[model samples]
Target: MHLHKINKVLICILLTYTVQYLMLPFPDLSAEEGVIFENPYKKTEKQTDVTQFTIYFTKKSHLIPKQDQVRLQSVADFLYRNRNFEILISAHSVEGKTNKENVLISEKRSLEVERFLLIHSVEPNQIRRLFYGNSKSPNLTKEHEALNRRVEILLQPIG
Candidate 1:
């Protein structure tokens, strides 16, 4: 009878250890904890990538300076690579002497970018333009005023 009791204790201890070993390996992935179980068998969809470019201007200057010509050429290369993409150029001016003068400057800045792209053989049809006169920069700081005078080129993929 004493031997019988020992056997029963050993069985209980073995069962306890086995239960702990099995339970420790997997976490409780219940919905209550916001743990999601992904289906490993499912496939993923392909995605397209869009690109953007920016060019900053000097105070009261509409020309693309000699230093920036290489940068502009790189952008032209990207445009050529993605032939189906459309370019949206938003030109902005720094705080100027007058609103009218600022607006004119902004237009000239956009035209200069457009002309540069055209000269690089980018299609005119792929380009759309907008200009913002001495409107404040999204970045509001005295130093960023030079940054405010700029063009934002947004590239959108076509279907």
Candidate 2:
């Protein structure tokens, strides 16, 4: 096949896979009345976001967008219900700052997220935090700098 035809075939395959993955029901852990689940992937009538997600922040800003408030509430609810699950929240900031200032910005972002979770009744012990300032961020162009300024959330079931 010609190089162009091969490229088109590769792109088609990737797009098809992406669509299928998105359409399928996510492995949501639905809780009812304080019951502990054996399998998190079990499907249910009412699904909540029990998976990992990101909270993005604007450049040099620690505030979360108003639109993401609802989503964070859902996460808070999930963590409150599943006491055996633990969440790691790592706050990050964009490059081009002194280490002291970078850490300060990330710290503010962490506090904001932790406060939200606490207000929603999530147990303080169920949460873990890390501050990764511009130190961990890779060198990137102007357009990609926004990607580095974010708070990444990860979830795992505790023993």
By lDDT, who's the top model here?
Answer: 2
Encode model 1's per-residue lDDT on 23-83: one tens digit a residue. Answer: 8755665334212122122232221222565666778888886645666676677788878
lDDT tens digits, residue span 90-121, model 2: 98886536878888888889889888889999
TM-score, per-candidate, Cα-based: 0.60, 0.65
Q: Ten-residue segment with the worst summed lDDT in candidate 2? A: 36-45
**Residue-level error in angstroms, candidate 2, position 15:** 44
Question: Model 2: clashing residue pairs?
Answer: none
The alpha-carbon deviation from the true structure for residue 139 of candidate 2, after best TM-score superposition, in angstroms, is: 4.7
Clashes of 2: 0
lDDT of each: 0.73, 0.75
- Candidate 1, residue 71: CA error in Å? 2.5
Best by TM-score: 2
